[model samples]
Target chain A: MSADATQRAPQGRTLSAAPGSAGLARRAWPWLVAIVAALLLPWLFFDWSTHRHSGFALTMLSEIGLMAIFALSFNMQMGQAGLLSFGHAILFGLGGYCAAHTMNAVKAGAMWLPVELVPLVGGLGGLLFGVLFGYVATKQRATAFAMITMGLGELVAACALMFMGFFGGEGGISTDRVIGISLFGVSYSSSWQVYCLVVAWTAIAVLLMRLQTQTPLGRMANATRDNFERAQFVGYDPRMVRFCQFALSGFFAGIGGGLYAIVYEIVTFDTVAAAKSATALLAAYIGGAGGFFGPFLGTIVVVLLQSGVSLLSNAWLLYVGVLFIVMVMYAPGGLVGIIAQHAPIARAGRLRELIVPYVRILLPGAFSVFGFVLLVELASFTTIGAAQGKAFKIGPQAVDPATAFPWLLGAAALIGGGLWLRLEARGFRARWDALMADAKAKGVML
Target chain B: MEVFLVSLLNGLVYGMLLFMLASGLTLILSMMGVLNFAHASAYMLGAYFAFTISQYIGFWPALVLAPLLCGTIGAAIEMYGLRRVHRNGHIAELLFTFGLALIIEKVVQMTWGLIPVPYRIPAGLDFPLFTVYGTQFPAYRAFMLLISALMFGAIWLGLTRTRIGLVIQAALHHPEMVGALGHNVPRVFTTVFAAGTALAGLAGVIGGNYHVTEPAMAFTMGPIVFVVVVFGGLGSLTGCFIASLLMGLIQTFAVVLDYSVADLLKWFGFTVTSATPFHEVLTVPLPRIGALLPYVLLVLILVFRPRGLMGTRDT
Candidate 1:
């Protein structure tokens, strides 16, 4: 599946770029802008009125950066290598645990390591586990590989619980990051300081991963992913390519885990759990595994939903699951692929042609989403919320769920809005088809 | 002796429940090349549906109705959801099911509340069936064994005896050939998927009461079922049965074995002190490690014998 998507990747690039060095520069520009943006974001979001930092914002931003690295690392196996690892977070978690240990050692003055280089220690720890497990995991392909990774993940997670010295059992290992160690004589005491560290590591990790995609090893990994037989016939050991890629992916994931440990000052079994692995998969796939920055965007969007949406409702995971299913079913190339598909049309200045159609589709679409959310929330409120002594309140009105009025409204909105959305969607499809034909006639191709 | 007899019976019951779930998964994985990650979720739904139905109409009627309901839901999902995603590839199908599993868990929680429903065996069958070494064996367990045995017989007969079963068997081995032979392959796919889910639902009906019908039961059982299917290898029912029974026995026996690796090492005069390397790993009791056994075995099997015991296909 990924093989088919990667085959069309160059075509995606061709829509917006000229060949040669100009295209290279165009590609490189995003990385530079991303780095600059990462560096400037904390300052940009500074609170002037309080005369104090927005620690929450900084922490959230740091989480995004950390998740971005994790997702990107995951994509190395998933998109580029076509190895769907079900246990990618083991490396991340192991790295975090190792980093936590390092933090403790540094705090005890038993180690002279600087705090800035802690993530590298984590990366090395990840690489160690990655190589060890990758040797076994990379022996198989596809489903078997995925299963083996899951087994390994479970094994490590179980061990993490069993061995308390290194893993610290259920409560996990915690450490103080403000251990009087300085990188450039800066105490690194504040969340912003940690956020800066995360941003720097994220930038480095992203750049390294992007660079890896251009290397011979990366190209071979893609070739191996596409066809193991073909790769083998061409004198490349597909297993070796997979192993190296897996190890490297683990290394980067470990770095992300290190950042997580450093920021949180703790590492636990949750870090290496299958759920954590699922998070990486969701982020990478939702963002567009086919694109370099797709997971980056996915990380931001998912982290926002996780941190932002979860505060208001307990159905955040439900929403993410729904979004993922929708993406997989309808848009396998993900968010970036959807956007990239319109590049030629946008470049031809015919983008406005679909505005009416988009509005037509989106109006009922919004209604459907709202209806669905309302139904889910009401159901949740009736069952769980009521039991918890929380009333269902919307603005000034406290709606009693026992009444049939709200239920009717929810059902009608869902069924009615869904039907209307279907109708509008057909109209939008017709308009889109017409616009595509027009674009084709105007010498614009997608 | 009583402990051994009881553990054996319990193991058999649990193994059969696992087989009911794993058999469907094996068929889906081998025939469609799509691992239905939401298979356990289907089981969860069956339990929830049975719980609700039994509350209204009693257990006996629910036993017949809940699986049928699940079969219908499974058919709808296959027709609308899996069929749409099938064009994309197996990975998409897998992800779709994975997402479905998540949604189902959440939906189950929302609809049924967060707590486990008091879904219990019927009073008619709640009494002890027999006494073994002065220990009473529950009649519900005997019923579970009977139902599972009946299901096994039915599935075996249907697959080997019926016309549709022949078509399904043919489809499993040669899907493209079956398609070329003017068979409605999509219909067959849907039927197989529905049948698989129905079997899972049936397992849920029995297993839920045997264990507990809760929101978290799906997640807890999901991985174990996957391990069974993988350990048995893909596309082989006999292997699945063997793996399930072996896993069941291992888990049950592990729980009963109070000894640790330290005990074993003591026979060789090796004392496991606190300062000793891997002391926790060595001293941890067998029952404490029971949860990790299946995963460890799964890894070992995948690494060593990828085709699994009696499996014709490599997973």
Candidate 2:
């Protein structure tokens, strides 16, 4: 059974009740807020120096939007259907290849397709492959299912490398996204314009995926995930539900891939590699696969770390691996789940009581994170960095890792902060329990 | 004929190495239900550990010491890491191992640097054993075969003869029942996990010298080992052996075959050209397509026969 299934009670039969407009508005507001926030973000990071928009911010935001779509699509399998796929990137990359080909065709005057519809072309490509591969992949459940997906992933990845005509071998296929065509009198040249396209598509993809979860098919997928034998007894073919979910996920992944192709104007074998698939898995799982917008948040955080943190340290992947392992072991609900766990306390207005405890833990937590990063950086610099002539710098002070003092300081900070954090965490947990008991006494049941 | 014989012998050597890795994996998968993504990482660790140890104490001592160290590390991981994450279900366990695989690879890179180490065969075993027509077969490969055959015998004896082995055999099929019968199931789990890692380490000790002992060797060998285990049929040692040998032979022979689908089309009197749809795919030589055969075979087996060739369970 899925991890989330044990934590929550089985949802009641509310599928038959039609959602009222008020209920619809309650659901729609989050998307509205998201859309408004996305539109306003580029402006917030505008650069006034060169009189040009912030290319870095726009590109990063665009990447975040694309990755969000990818992770959300991945969640359809993992979070909803309980189908863990290691080959979802196949659809995304296939979609990208299709979009790239379409762009080339348009540039060659062989086709008159609008740039806006290219993502749709990518989705179609994803759907085609999803149906083809899903039939074989969905035949097994649990470990077998995971293994089959991995095999398919490897098969497609190998094919992508060998079949140079379409995949373009190692260098991959590149095309011009501009195409000299105007859609709504906006010539697509600037990174900002591409960011607009990504936002629009990401919103559509997210809304569509959310709507999908409300449908009977979506509920059936959850039913299948929870108990396949029970789902079978209820006259539903679990395989069919899995197949549909897998195909739909492919379509969304393809849309994400389409945006990727459009933004970069190139698609490579790396786009469809196992590493890219792992990224989707990491983002979705870390963000909290149990919630709708969990993957979106996870994607933004991961992309930020991938872009921002990678700039400062070489041990960024190591940090991500540690973070992912920590999440899996301790917080299976992910970052979103942790926030949602405190929803009742916030509603009961008892959230203020936890502030002191949270700060107590937070200070030590920050210190530990800093200390851990310092140790990793010092080790990395001494080994790999020094070879490349890179020096470790903190503000105005440049510390040489070869010196015994720096090593002692790093070790002291890490050990000291780690011990302090552990102590703080225990106290915080105790205080949290007290707050929970007080809230329960007040009849604010959680 | 010479090419065929040389390839066959080479394939057998490679197959035995694969079986050493897959046998351990098959046992772990049956018992734990985890794919053990870090299995190959353990193998890589074995290779690296051997390289480090052999540098100081020579190859003979390193062979025994490296695998023992790997087994201890495996036991520690199971006791601390896997035991902590076990309550989250198989997916979490799998993810934990996947993360561990990444961390291991990174750590390996950090410790050894990102390049192939000179972990070659010992000077005593460097010479060729015999000449097959014009081709030479190395004594080191014969040594690998001898080591693997001894391991196979040892594993077989330990499983059938010892009391712990019998308990492990029982737990492999019906773990809960064994646990209910008052056998220390968790201890058995740790032992089995450690043994599996040790076997992988042993494979690495020998295979690394035959191949290159590089940081990326884990990733390069990881998928192929999975293919062997899956193709052999989950939880069946005999099936794993057969699948390993078959895959090894197929991969070896495919590299020697230069023909393609276009050649078959030519025999059928079909005039194929560049204008033909899927022309590239048809005309590609089998040798060039060798890298894809295992994956293709894996998919076909999973789709057509989910139980694998000799698997009793539905994998």
**Quality of candidate 2 docking, DockQ:** 0.66
* Candidate 2 segments whose C-alpha is farther than 4 A from its true place: A1-26
How many angstroms is residue A205 displaced in model 1 relative to the true structure, after the best TM-score fit?
A: 0.5
* DockQ scores for all predicted structures: 0.75, 0.66
The candidate that wins on DockQ is: 1
TM-score of 2: 0.95
User: What tens-digit string does per-residue lDDT give for candidate 2 at B211-259?
Assistant: 9998899987888888898888877888999998998898899999899
What class would a CAPRI assessor give candidate 1's docking?
Answer: medium
Candidate 2: RMSD over Cα atoms?
3.9
Cα error, candidate 1, residue A76 (Å): 0.5
TM-score of each: 0.95, 0.95
**With candidate 2 superimposed using the best TM-score fit, by how many Å does residue A312's alpha carbon deviate from the native?**
2.0
